[model samples]
Target: MRKATFIIPAIVIVMAIIMSSVFIVDERQRALVLRFGDIRSEIEEPGLNFRIPIIEQIVLYDSRIQSLDTAPIEVTPSDDRRLVVDAFARYRIIDTRQFRLAVGNGGLREADRLLEDILNPQIRAVLGADGVTSNTILSSDRAELMQRITAQARVLAEPLGLDVLDVRLKQTALPLQNLEATFARMRAEREREATDERARGEEAAQRVRAQADRTVVELVSDSAREAEIIRGEADAERNRIFAEAFGQDPDFFEFYRSMTAYERALTGENSSMVLSPDSAFFDFFAQPGGRAPAAVPAPVE
Candidate 1:
C-alpha cells in the first residue's frame, strides 16, 4: 500500500509537468519562447512545441493579416487647402521574433500603436507633397497617392516587424468650417450661370419679337398700298363711265345731273335754302324741260 501511494503521486506530478511544458502551435498563429524576459526561439510552423517549465514562457501572435484604423487627421495640400483625412492600413507581423522583441509583452495592441505612428506621417507627407493637391486626393489619382503612402509606410514599418500591405483613404473631405463657404460659392456660381442663360434667352426673344414686329409693319404697309391702288383704279373707272354717258346725250345728262343736285339739296324735312326765283339752280323746277327761259331783249336806248 505504501509503494502504490508513492507511484500514483509520481505519475500525477509527471503529468503536470508534461502539460505545463508542451504547447501546440496553431496554423493561424506564431509562437515564441521567452527565457528570462528575452526571446529564445521563434516557432514558425504549426506543430507540438516544448519549453522548460517555470524557466521558459510561450507567446503566440496571430499570423494573419490585420487592419488598423487611424484617427481622422487634418492635412494641408500644396494648394493650401485643408482637408480632414481618415485612413486605414492592412498589415501583418512578418517577423515574429522581431515583433516580440519590439513590442515586448504588449503584443498586438502595442504593435498597432507603433504602426499608427509610422502610417500617419506618411499619409501627411504623401498627401501634402508639392504636387499633390486636394483635388488629386479626392480624385481617382488618390489610388496612386495611397500606393505612395503604402510604400513609404512599409519602409518605416520594417523595423517594427510589420509589413504594411496596403493603405487606403477611408474618407477625404473639407473641414467642417469650410463646407458652408464652399457650398455658398457653388450656389453663387450656379446662380450666375442661370442669370447668364436667362439673359441670353431674353435677348433671343427680343430679336424674335423685333423680327415679328417688322414683318407685321411690312405686311400692313403692303395691304394699305394695295387698298389705295384699288380705290384709285375704281374711281377712274367710275369717271370713265360718267364721261361715256355724257358723250351719249348732253341734254339727258344735264337733266340727270340737275335732278340729282335737287334731290341732294332738298333731302330731309329740315333742309331749307333761300334763293331768288330767277336763280339758275331753280331753273329745272321752273321749266318742264329744265331749260332756262330766254330773256327779252333790252329796250332800245
Candidate 2:
C-alpha cells in the first residue's frame, strides 16, 4: 500500500510538469519565448515548443497580412488646395522579434497606432511636394501618389517590424465651402457658353433674314420691270393694228371716230355739254339722213 501511493503521486506530478512545459505554436501565429521579460527564442514554424514552466513566458503574434484604416486627415497639396483624405494600408509583421521588442505585448493594436503616426506625416510630406496638385490626386496620377506614400511609409515602418504592402486613398474631397464655390464657378462657365451659342445662333438667323429680304427686293424689282416691258409692247402692237385698219377705209374710220366722240359727249343721264350748232363734233347728230362725213386725204411721205 505504501509503494502504490508513492508511485501514483510521482506519475501524477510528472504528467503535470510535462503538460506545463509544452506549448502549441499555431500555423497562423508566431511564438516568442521571453525569460524574465528578455526575448530568448523565436518559434516561427508551427509545432510543439518547450519552455520552463514557471520561469519562461510565451507571447503569440499573428503572421498574416493585416489592415489599418486611418482616420480622415486634411492634406494640402502644392497648389494650396486643402482636401480631406481617408486612407488605408495593408501590412504584415515581418520580424516577430523586432515587433515584440518595439511594440511590446500590445500586438496588432500597438502596431496600428504606430503606423498611423508614421503614415500621416509622410502623406503630408509627399503629397505636398512641389507640382503635386489636387487634380493629380483625383486623376490618373492617383495611383502614383499612393505608390509614393506606400514606399515612403515602408521605410518608416521597417523599425516597427511592419512591411507596408500597399497604401490606398479611400476618399479625397474638398470641403463644403469649396464645393459650393466650385459649383458656382461651373455654373458661371456653362452660362457663358450658353450665351455665346445663343449669340451665334442669333447672328446666323439675322444673316439668313437679311439674305431673304434682299432676294424679295430683287424679285419684286424684276417683276415690275418685266410688267412694264410687256405693257409697252402691247400698246405698240395695238397702235400698229389700228393704223392698218384705218389705212384700208379712210371715210369709215372718220365716221367711226365721230360716233365714238358723240357717245362720249352723251355718256350718262346727268351728263350735258353746250356746243355750237356748226361744230364738227355735232356732225353725226345733225345729219338726219345718215349722210357720211368727207374722207380725210392721206398725206404724202
Candidate 3:
C-alpha cells in the first residue's frame, strides 16, 4: 500500500513539472524566454516551446501590424497660418528581441508612448517645412507630405525596433480662431462675384430694353411718315379733280363754291354775318331758280 501511494504521487508531480516546462507559442505571436528577469532567447517561429520549470518565464507579443491614432495637433505652415492636424500610423515589430529589450515589461504601451514622441516632431518638421503652405497641406499633395513624414519617422523609430509602414494625415482644418476670418473672407468674395454677375445681367437687360425701344420708335416713325405721304397724295388728287370741274364750267363752279361757303358760315346756333343786301355774297340767295351769273372769261397768263 505505501509503495503504490508513493509511486502515484511521484507520477503526478512529474507530469505537473512537464506541463509547466512546456509552452506553446501561437502562430500570431512572437515569444521571449526570460531567466532571472533577463531575456535569454527569442522564439520567432510558432511551434511547441520548452522552458525550465519555476526558473524561466515566457513573454508573448503580437507580431501583426498595429495602428496608432495621434491626438489632434496644431501646426503652423510656412504661410504663418495655423491648422489642426489629426494623424494615424501603421507599424509592425520586425525585431521582437530588440523590442522586448527596449520596452521590457512595459511592452507595447511604452513603445507606443515612444512612437508618439517620435511622431510629433516628425509631423511638425515635415508639415512646417519652409515654403509648405496650408493650402498644400489641405490638398491632395498632402499624400506627398505624409510620405516624407513616414520616411523621417521611420528613421527615428528604428531604435524602437518598429518599422513604420505608413503615416497619414486624417483630418486637416483651420483653428477655431481663424475659422470666422476665413468664412468672412469667403463670404466677401462670393458677394463680390454676385455683384459682378448682377451688374452684367443689368447691363444686358439695358441693352435689350434699348433695342426694343429703338425698334418701337422706328416702327412708329415709319408708320407716321407713310400716313403723311398718303394724306398729301389724297389732297393732290382732290385738287386735281376740282381743277377739272372748274375748267368745264367757270360760272357754275363759282356759284357752287359760294353756296358751300354760305352753308358753312350760316350753320350752328346764333350764327350771324353783317353784310350789305346787294353784296356778291348774297348772289346765291338772290337766285332761287339757280340762275347763272355772267360768264367770266379766263384771265391772260
Candidate 4:
C-alpha cells in the first residue's frame, strides 16, 4: 500500500511537468526561444518542442506572408497642394536568424511608428523631388517610386532584421474643400471654352450667310441687266429689218403709209371736208413732189 501511493503521486507530478515543458509548433509557425530576455535559439520548422518549464520563453510568429497597413499621412505636392495618403505592404522573413534580430512590434502600431518616422519622410522626399506632381504617390512611375521607398525601408528595417518586399498605395485624396474648389475651377474653364467655340462658329456662319446673300443679289442684278440689253437689241434688230424691207418696196410702202395716215386722220365719226380744185391736197393727187398741173387732165377720148 505504501509503494502504490508513492507511484501514483510520482506519475501525477511527471504528467504535470511534461505538460509544462511541451509546446506545439504548427506548420505555419516559427518560434524564437529566449533565455534571459535574449534570443537563445530559433525553430523554423513545425514539430514538437521541449523547453525548460520556467526558465526558457518561446515567441511564435506566422511564417507565411504577412501584411502591414500604415496610417494616413498628409503629403504636400510640388504644386503646393496637400493630399491625404494611405498605404500598406506585404513581407516575409527569409532568414530566421535575421528575423529574430530584426522583428520588433509585429502589429499596425509598430508600422505606424515606422511610417511616421522613416516612411513618411522618404515618401515626401521622393514624391516632391519627382519630375512629376507633388501628389505623385501612385503613378506611371509608381513601381520605380516604390522601389526607391522599399530600399529606404530595408535600411530602416535592417537593425530589426526585416526585409521590405513591396509597398503599395491604397488610397489618395485631397482635402474636401480643395477638391470642391478644383472641381469648380475645372467646370468654369470648360464652360468658358465651350462658349468661345460656339461664338466663333456663329461668327463663321454669319460670314458665310452674308457672302451668300451678297452673291445672290449680285447674280439677280446681273441677270436683269443682261435680259434688258437682250430685249433692246432684239427691238433694234426688228426695226432694222423693217427699214430694209421698206427700201425694197418704195411705191407700195408710200401707198400703205398714205392709207394708214388717212385711216388715222379721217375717221367715219368725223365729217369729211370738201377742198377747192386748187388746194394743196389736190396737188399730191395730181402729180408727185406736191406740184399741181396748170390745167386739169382731160377725160380719155
Which TM-score value belongs to model 4? 0.71
Which model is ahead, 1 or 2, in terms of lDDT? Answer: 1
- Residue 226, candidate 1: Cα error in Å is 3.0
lDDT of 4 by residue, 11-77 (tens): 9999988998899889998887878668889998899999887788888877776677777877776
For residues 105-188, write the lDDT of model 3, one tens digit per residue. Answer: 888888888899999889999889998999999888989999999999999888888999999988899999899999999999
> Per-candidate RMSD vs. true structure?
6.6, 5.4, 4.7, 9.2
Best by lDDT: 1
**Deviating ranges (above 4 Å) for candidate 1:** 241-301
Ranking by lDDT: 1, 3, 2, 4
Give the alpha-carbon lDDT of every model.
0.89, 0.87, 0.88, 0.71
Scored against the true structure, residue 85 in model 2 reaches a CA lDDT of 91
Clash number for every model? 0, 0, 0, 4
| TM-score per candidate, chains pooled | 0.81, 0.77, 0.81, 0.71
lDDT of 4 at 211: 100
Alpha carbon lDDT of residue 265, candidate 1?
Answer: 72
Give the clashing residue pairs of candidate 2, or none: none
